[model samples]
Target: MRALTVKQPWADAIAHGEKRIENRTRPIPPKHLGTTILIHAGATEDFNALPADMVRAWPKDVRAVVALATLAGCHKAAKPRCCAPWGFPDTWHWELKDIRPIPHPPRPVRGQLGLWTVDDDTLAAVQRQISIERTSA
Candidate 1:
């Protein structure tokens, strides 16, 4: 599966269904639309950089794929609107849906820019985790 590395708080927010739109400086490729992708939490964190309210809800895990979400669509934002709460002017907003957390990620992996492929072993592990989550639920 393809994955995107997003910074903390935002990644956590998306995983927990708190954020529905991901703001990007550039648009995602058209082919990615309607695709299910892994949501990788980046390794870096700057608690001081985030707003106080956001810092309170931050997830502890970093440098791992925390969730899976469908890339519902990508749109160009003419201005800051309801879709993206932290959106910047003229940025691309990627709509995400069906966000589900992995609970315990299979393993940690370094993140990269754009959409990157997940290794088979890791993907299988993630699938196992998903299976466990479903059965338990």
Candidate 2:
């Protein structure tokens, strides 16, 4: 599965369903639309940079694969809407759908910029985690 590395608090927010749109400087490629992607929380903690309310609602897990979401579409907006609070003007908003948190504990992995491929072993682990989440849900 493909994965996108997102920064700490925002990643956690996406995994927990508090945020549904991911803000980016560039638009996602057309091929990524309607595809499921892993949300990898990057290894950077900036709690002081986040809003106090968000800091208060931080997820227990970080710096790992926290969830899976469908990349529904991507759009550039002059004024932010779905992800306005977390987005800057003139950025692309990647709409997300069918967000699901991984039931198992977060698996640590190094993250890279833009969309990247997950290795076979990590993919298998993530698949297993998703399977468990499905059965339990």
Each candidate: what lDDT? 0.77, 0.76
- Give the range of the ten consecutive residues with the poorest summed lDDT in model 2: 128-137
Error in Å for residue 48 of model 1: 3.6
Model 1: per-residue Cα lDDT over 23-135, one tens digit each: 89878787777888899988886656556777676564788888988888878886436564655567788888888898787558889989989888878888987842221
In candidate 2, which residue ranges exceed 4 Å CA deviation? 80-82, 132-137
Candidate 2 backbone collisions, by pair: none
If scored against the real structure, what TM-score would every candidate get?
A: 0.84, 0.83
How do the residues 1-137 of candidate 2 rate in per-residue lDDT, one tens digit apiece?
Answer: 78899887778778864688788888988877778888998888676766777657557466688888888888886653445665566778888888888766456788888988877788788777665232110
Worst lDDT run of 10 residues, candidate 1, spans 128-137
Q: In angstroms, give how far residue 40 of model 1 lies from its true place.
A: 0.2
User: lDDT of candidate 1?
Assistant: 0.77
Residue 64, model 1: lDDT of 86
- List the RMSD of every prediction in angstroms: 4.3, 4.1
User: Candidate 1: lDDT of 129?
Assistant: 78
Candidate 1 TM-score, true structure as reference: 0.84
